[model samples]
Target chain A: MKPRVGATLASTTDQTTVIVVRWGAEDLDVTCGGAPMVDARGPEAGTSHPADPAQQAGTVMGKRYASEEHGVELLCTKPGSGTLAIGGVPVPLKDAKPLPASD
Target chain B: MNITVLLDMAADGFGDRVVVGTREAGLTAQALRARASAGAALVEAEGADAILHLAVNTPAFPVALFAAGLAGVPLVPVNYRLGAEQLDHLVGNHPRALVVADERQRAAIERAGLTARTPEEFLQQTRTPAPHAVEPREVDPDSAAVVIYTSGTTSAPKGVVLTHANLVSYVLGTVEYGAAAEDDAALMSVPPYHIAAVSNALTNLYAGRRVIVLEAFTPQDWVETVRDQGVTNAMVVPTMLARIMDEPGLDRSVPSLRSLAYGGAAMPRRVVEQALREWPAVDFVNAYGLTETSSTITVLGPEDHRAGGERLSSAGRAVPGVEIQVRADDDTPLPAGTSGHVWVRGEQVSTAYAGGGSGSSLDADGWFHTRDRGRLDAEGYLFLEGRVDDTIIRGAENIAPAEIEDVLQRHPDVADAVVVGVPDEEWGQRIEAVVVPRRGVDLDAEALEALRATVRGSLRGAKTPDRIVAWAELPRTPTGKLVRRDVVAGLAR
Candidate 1:
């Protein structure tokens, strides 16, 4: 699915949820624990899906996972024991440098 | 994209951290979240479309903001300083709003035929169990999160609508998650109506920092609050910083202050220099942006202040998600160092006004044309040269008033200065300046001529002010923005 920015996605295998912050690639194969995620606002959001235990690397809340080549970024809203991947390649956690608060 | 997500993140990440009020008796992130739920219930019960904040800085400000997101309504913060007529006109726009007003605004709220609650009353409501259970509702990202009315120079004030997407993009792009230490606190002095207040509340809370509100701003009160509250961070306007420097008989030592950000208007070089010398340990940031944008777009960091040459006067580079472009009168893009009109484009920029008034709206290309005339240096640092409308157009040449004003302010005898264009038969417009004298020195005939000579030495002869009038003080807004229209009217009289 080619979801827009600010779209929320949830994993069926567990209580993993994320908000899409940036997107560029046309085709999306976003997976959590080897199962495709569904729209968080859809009826199937919290339903159970088949899971593979080997893909469980865990997603952390408040951590941003990104893939530079695909230009994809996601902010983890709920922690779950599943790695977030696009087309089966795990995205790395982005290192964040804090800026001085300038209001 | 809802702003409530930030509150939820803070509550989930650092539930026990104090995020609001006094350090001794402040609300933790978890408590604030619960209060937000109850506030949302109150809003739902009232059937209000908006929460109109007609008061000063209070804890109710944040509660209403978060509650609005939960109820999928906009938070409209109106300036309480407006007169009766202006207040009535503004209050009319939001008839179906739950107004949280102060005691002085009682008559205005009553005149509008709306029931109003005090900030204290609203705070108390949040403490008690909600009348109804409220589950956090997700709002459309494109919906308005805030509506801030800005007083214009020529027309009635217009409301700048800030969307949830705009605010969320700004917060996520600029701040790192969980950045603040356990004990870090921020002292907020800007009024609740201003975008600085809203932006600061979101940024500080998301960073897991405590925020203490200084209801009204006095230099002595601000200094004492910083020391007493253990404030590690603070934000102020140039005028407030100037007053802090000028105020005497106060212990100005702020050892706990780690960062100080000042903006809303241009900073006097003298005041900035003195502040840097006085607080050598504090990190300084010069933030520049408009109410149309969420908050800051360009910032001169602490390292830039330490480097401190010509860039100190500049507005520094654009923030991560924003792009700045300089264009000529013909709409052609200008290269670096060429002064022209400034245009900006970013997700955080909301160029649209609520009820269309007179102002620049966003173009088809998503670029918001700013009234400012500025230039970017070779290294992409922005140097603002006053407003384009404020530019002095002579027979042919367009002159910037800020250049002359800077020179006038630099004169030893002059404490403040304002350069304006007055009507003239020979030139389309002639340069006129108003100068305020330093405490002890008299800006007599000799001193005025000396000040003119200083401007002549720096700029060309034509750029000099033809008539220099001495005034006790120049007119300005509370945030130090010049009331040029008022000044021109005063000069005409």
Candidate 2:
């Protein structure tokens, strides 16, 4: 699916949800828990594949997953038993670059 | 598109980090989120339509903010310093709100006959989990996230409607996520009702910086807190800066202070220059914007101050994703170096106000009429002349009081100055000024005459003040904005 900033996506297997925080201009294959993520409402009930062990590294709520090569960032809104991947490659968590605190 | 998304990200990114209050026992990211989650459940259980925060800035303030967002309702932060009649009128507007207030503000809540909770009690109630995991609804981007009341210096206060999109755009555009150093702490001195307070709360948290709020402000206390807390960044109004710069026999050293931002009113050239000289290691930023614009649209970075000269007074260039223009009365675009009405169009700009729907002060093309008279230089530097309403018409010539007052403030004897237009049978309206001379210097005729001559030398004779009086101090809002109406009445008296 085309990855866009501020767009929400939901996992097919479980209740995992994520929002794209930053992304490059080009479209990329973004998936959660070994299945293609659908819109905020998710896909029809039975269309999802059963959770796979290799892809079930599991996601923690509120963690961010990013692909530096593709310049894509996703914020996990819900936890699930699936890893975030781009083009079938597992994406690594990106570290935050701290700014001077200005209130 | 709910505001809670920001909080959720923060909790997940650094759940154990202290994001609010003192570093030792401040509320952690996970704690804040849990409190907000529990508080949202309370809001739902009470069936409240909105959350009305009528207290000073506290740890509970941020919890209430995100809780209200998770509850799918607007958070209305009202000024607690308003007069009885004004306070009553504003309180009456929110009958279905959950009133969260302090002891000093309990009267307004009691008068409204609504169930109220103190900040401590509010925090305690949110400690327990609800029957089920409270999930925040997917709110629309255009839903009202917060409604901030204007200072109402010229007229009755009106609620400025800021949607989730307006505030989210501001944070995402201006701030990078988790951008603060692990030990960085931000000292916030602005009041709870100000837009800076709301925006600052969210931005500082999202940046993973610990926030320290000074419920009350005094120069001594502020400096001491900075020194003790090792605060890395801070924000202040012009008056607060002036007070800090002029505090007598005080230790002005803040070794950890790296960035200081001043806004909410025009900064005198002398004060800013002194600040830059005294704290050479510190970076000074001049952020210019309004509540309707979601805080800052233009920023004069520290480099501009080092440039010195006339750039000292310039409000600097627009921030990213924002466009600024100067327009004549007929909506014609003005050329650079020509003073006219300032207009701004941007995603962060909230062109909507309560009672009046979206696009009230904005044109059909989405440009918001700032109602501020200013000029843009060829390099895109914005120089504010004053408000359109503050212009003095003297013999058909539009004279900006800020222009004359700026010159007056530069004088060695002048500590503060304000120029106002007094009704006159001749010349339509004559320019009158009130000057607050430096301490220990009497406002003698010689000093007043020298001020008049100085203004006359730089500006046209018609622009000079016809009558300049000496006042111990001028009336100003709590946020350092001059009360022009009060000044006009003072001149009349």
Candidate 3:
């Protein structure tokens, strides 16, 4: 699927929803619970998919999942029992680099 | 990109953490979200076009900010210190606004014939659970998030419109989400009307830090609050910093204060030096910006302050995502170290003013003419000379008041100083100064002579002040910005 910053996506195999925070150079094969995600209009519209037990690693709300090789960053907007992956590779939680807060 | 999304992120990232007011009684991130939802429901029910807050910085302030976002109404924080007639004039402009004001301010809001709520009532109403849950509406990132009236020193006040995307861009570029330690707390002293206050609320919340507001600021009270709250980070304007630094009775020691950020106006070199000496361990940041720039565009970080040299006087380098350039009268870019008009371009710069549809302030290229005169050093450090409008033309030579003011500040007996151009028959304009003497120092004729000689020696004689007057205190806006118009009018009289 094509990744665009601020675009919301919902898992096809679970109730996971995420927003792309950063896009990569190429289209991403992003998936959750062993199924590709699709554009989500509302919460109810994305929750009917059943998760595959093998890929139910779960996603944490507000945590950012990043693929370094793909240069993509997705922020979890809703928690679900679905592991977020890109091209069958599980995405790692992006570490926050604390900068001096500009207020 | 909507401002509410930041609140949503906070609620999701640290739902149980206290993010507003005092930690013991403050609303947690989750609680705040619910309250804001209820408040948004109220706003929608009322069909308000805007949420105007005429109150001091308090717990309700942050709630109103988020609620307005959720309601898709721009939040307008009016200066609580405006006089009756002035307040009436400003409030009258927002006839469709739902005003949340303090007790004393209710009369003005009523006079404007608008719906009003007290701070307590606002809090309670926002906290009251709705009979049925109100679904949040999708907010356009380009929509107005906040409308702050510029503190007009030389002309009538104009509203500066900051969009949700502008603020979100600033926060996303500057802060790492949920970056603060679980116990980290920020002491917010700037008034709610100032851009610093609004930006501080959003950025600190996004960083997962609790914010405690000081309703009124006294040097001793600020220090005590920092100590009492175990505040790790705090923000103050230059005037506030000067007061805190010079207060002889202050204990001046805060073990928990890890970072102190100051902006709003030019910081005196002496004040910064004294503060460094007083608290060597604290990280001091000198942020330089305007309301139109969404708070800060450049920052002199702690490392630069620690190194201490000419850079201490600079506004530091431009922050990531902001590009700054100095331009000449012909709009050509000036060479490095050559002072000229400061121009900035960034995602955070607001391109329009209220009722003034995209004025010439923003060029076709998206670059905003800051109307500030400054120069970037060879190393890219920005040194603010003064406002372009503040230039004093003496016999065809343009002189910046900041240059003379800096020299006056170097005087040991001078506590504060401001230089302005005065009408003169001989020269196009003559430079005049207003000085606040240090406490207990009698500024006699001999001392005045010494001050004049100091300025003449350091700067050209034409650039020196033609006349100097003593004032107990200069006229300043609520946010500590010098009201130069008042000073000039007073001098004229």
Candidate 4:
């Protein structure tokens, strides 16, 4: 499914949860811990498949996971053992520089 | 979706860091959350639907705000500068509200037969854990998060309602979560009632920046506070920046300050020019928006300030996720450089009022009529002429001419009165009134002073005319409608 902005996703394998902040591509399979994460509101929001040990590196809350190559940004609203992946490749955590306070 | 998400994320992300007040003794993210939870218990016990903040900027302000969020209530921060009757009228809006008022304004709150707690008492009360702590309730994003009362062209003040969705969208669209460095602090000089104050609290906290408040503004005190506090970022109105730049022989050197944002009114061209020379190291940003639009919709970034010469006067381009356009009265889009009413559409824009309001401001196409006259350059830089409505914005406060005019016309000796805003170096616009005297009465200098005093007697000091002049007649159309531009031109002459 094409992940829409503001759509929350929870890991089926672990406690990881994320909100899609920005999306640039039309179709991309977003996964965490080698398991396809389900919509937070869906019945399969958790525990569909066991997390792959190799990909279970974990995610930190409030840290953004983004793949420049894949054109996607996901903010880790809730952290867990499952790491975020965009189409099977683990996305790097690269935070953008702080803009000057405008308020 | 709720604003609590931001606070919760901050608490977990950096719970130990002092996100508010002095670095030595401010509330940490975790402490703020605990206090908010404790405060929520109090709110639920009182059965209040809203939390009214009738005080200056304080640490307790944020506590009350989050407490309302946690308890599923809206936080209504009102302008304390208003007159007693006005204050009472606004306080009456929420009879079942928990008011955090200053000592001076407590009587008005009490007069309304509502319970009022001083900010200190509120802090003290929230410090203790309630017998039964209320859990964070899942709030509807569409519900009102903040209601601010602002006087527009009409004499009556209408409450502008901002939902959690609008605020959350503003933060999510503009701010990167936990982006501030551990030492980054922002000094806020704007009053608690303004939209900037609410947005600043949410955005700065979400960015992990420490928040500091300047209750009283003196150019000397402001400069020294930045230096003493090691404040990295700050927000001010145009007047504050103007005084800091023009005040001769003041120690203005601040090595710690990095960014200074000025807004709330049209920035004087001379002030902006001098400030650029005075503090070349500081990243000066010009943010322009209204209470209806959840703070900043357009921003003149630091890069544009130095390079863009003529565009310095411009309010700059729209921020991300927001679209800006210039349209005629007929709702047709205007071409570049043609001045017309400014219209904006975004996730952050809230056209709703506390009640249904006068009428729908949003059109069938979903664009909000900003009621501001401005033209967009080919590059999309917005140059604002002024507001289409005759609301006079003096510094940060919006004053209705009709409100003061009604008072002037009430005096027995006064025949006719028209209050208008005149451009000034200090105040972006100063209030000036032209009066027509009663038949056979002398409209002398004394009479002008008397008329000024008459307005002061009826209204607040901020609403009183700064200068009053006597005129034989006022320029009006055949239908007897005011020709505001002509009056302004006559005042200039």
Q: Mind giving the per-residue lDDT tens digits that candidate 4 earns over B168-206?
A: 878877888888999999999988888889999999999
Candidate of highest DockQ: 1
Candidate 3 structure quality by residue, lDDT tens digits, B295-371: 88999999999999999999988876799999998999999989999999998999778778745458889899988
Leading candidate by lDDT: 1
Candidate 4 docking quality: incorrect, acceptable, medium or high: acceptable
| True-structure RMSD for candidate 4 | 10.2
List the candidates' TM-scores in order: 0.96, 0.89, 0.92, 0.78
The digit string of per-residue lDDT tens for model 1 on B1-493 reads 8998899889988999989999789989998888888988988998999999999998899999998888899999998988899999999999999989998898999999998999999999899868677976767888899999985754578899999999988898888777889999999999999899999999999989999999989999998999998999999998899889877676789999999999998888877888999999999999999888899999899999988878889888888889999999987999998999999999999967887764547887889887899999988899999999999987798999999988887676777889998888999998989988877777888778877888888998999999788888889877778888777777888
Clashing pairs in 4: A12-A47
Q: List residue ranges in candidate 2 displaced over 4 A.
A: A1-7, A10-36, A44-102, B357-359
lDDT of 2 by residue, B55-130 (tens): 8899888999999999888899989899988988888888999888888888778888887899899988887876
Chain B only: TM-score of model 4 = 0.81
Best by TM-score: 1
- Candidate 3 chain B has its poorest 10 consecutive residues by lDDT at B352-361
- Candidate that beats the other on TM-score, 1 or 2, i.e. the better one: 1
What order do you get sorting by lDDT, best first? 1, 3, 2, 4
Clashing residue pairs found in predicted model 1: none
Per-candidate Cα RMSD to the true structure, in Å, reads 2.0, 4.3, 2.9, 10.2
